[model samples]
Target: MSSLSMDKIVELQAWKLKELLKWREYLGVLVEAVKEVFNDRVEVYVFGSAVNGRLTVSSDIDIAIVLSEVPKSGLERARLVDKIWSVMENKGVPWWYPFEIHLLRREELSLLREAKFTRLL
Candidate 1:
């Protein structure tokens, strides 16, 4: 903590507070967004720095989305990933830094590692 400048500390606190206050609201927005394309077969989670309370204002939001229905082929998976990516990459997103969205299928839960994920939907 000593190494961090006062301004940086203040920035981190503000960012943490913003996330704390809006996390549920943000998750609701995420649910609505995912439901538009994914229907009820998806789960959205907040993970990484945000989940662990180490986020700075500039730290990216890390997310993991798990689809209930797994695509059968590599091409299909790629397309699914692309579709979800497009949804996440929409320009109107509110965060200061771009989010890292990990799109996976139920069978790929093993892909999540070291991330402390909190499921929102």
Candidate 2:
């Protein structure tokens, strides 16, 4: 059996949600930075545990960047991801806050919906 009781689990989950809510402002800043670079060609979404009410202690917030066109080269994609990471870091996102940035084309939005994702920006 688990060490945590049902009430304890509920409390922990609520705490996780509260912790995630605190980071939404930083996420807004990130969205603006990406928008500055991509203009209207970008849309940002927050999916996975953060949006699905299944956040675990180890869950990393998942961010999806939906664009008109995803970079074709892996190197370009890596650079873009790195730049976004830098923006988050500069905006005071702590290293301990686990998160992921994914690049996708407009066509992939349907897939995100199928996977039960939510848009943040």
Top TM-score hit: 2
Tens-digit per-residue lDDT, 1-121, candidate 2: 4656877888987887667666566777778668766766578888887677776666777888998888899999999887877777777876556678889998877777756676767
Write the residue-wise lDDT of candidate 1 on 1-121 in tens digits. 4656878888877966676545445565566567666766788788888788886656667778887676678787767655654564472446443556667777677666666888888
Off by over 4 Å in 1: 1-25, 69-92, 95-97
lDDT of predicted model 1 = 0.67
Q: Report how far residue 2 has shifted in candidate 1, in Å.
A: 25
Tell me the TM-score of model 1: 0.58
Q: Candidate 2 clash total? A: 0
Worst 10 residues of 2 by lDDT: 16-25
Q: Which parts of model 2 have CA positions greater than 4 angstroms off?
A: 1-21
